[model samples]
Target: MPKMVFIETDGTRREVDAPLGLSILEVARRHDIDLEGACEGSLACSTCHVVVAPEWYDLLPDAQEDEEDMLDLAFGLTKTSRLGCQIRITPELDGLTVKLPGAK
Candidate 1:
């Protein structure tokens, strides 16, 4: 099983199992992490926004236009911002790390 790290809003680092094929949002939900995927991976909202660690950001596939549009509405967006639902776990992304944006 591959592993991934999630940096919570308070800066806690959590490493959790990331089953292949599951989206980052799914991984967060599985671990009880506080990622509010309001649209349930439908790409309809920005509630599942996550800032990918700079080191791991380029490893992800580029965001499609729709995801980019939704990300525009995300709070605390960053250069590496991504919608957690749009990224799926793969062998190349075994140690992915993302930061939960602070709440509004």
Candidate 2:
């Protein structure tokens, strides 16, 4: 089992062990992390935006055009920002930290 760390908008941290290949949004929803998936991972809404820890940013896949388009609508876009719904968890991403962005 692989695990990832989710730092909620209110500063609460949760470590969830999950199988690989599930999106980060799925993991957060499973653990009740309050990550809004307004578009249900469709790459349509920016509601599931989150900031990947700087150290783990390079390890993840590059954001696609649609993800970038949606990110532009996020409330607190940052250099380390990414769409949680677009990030699939993997063993290589274990220990990765994602900060839930403020709601739109």
Largest TM-score belongs to which candidate?
1
Residues 13-92 of candidate 1 have per-residue lDDT tens digits of: 99999999999999999999999999999999999999999999999999999999999999999999999999999999
lDDT of 2: 0.88
Candidate 2: give the clashing pairs.
none
Model 1 misplaced stretches (Cα beyond 4 Å): none
Please state every model's RMSD to the true fold in angstroms: 1.7, 2.1
Q: Alpha-carbon error at 64 in model 2, in Å?
A: 0.7
RMSD (CA, angstroms), candidate 1: 1.7
How many clashes in each structure?
Answer: 0, 0
TM-score of 1: 0.97
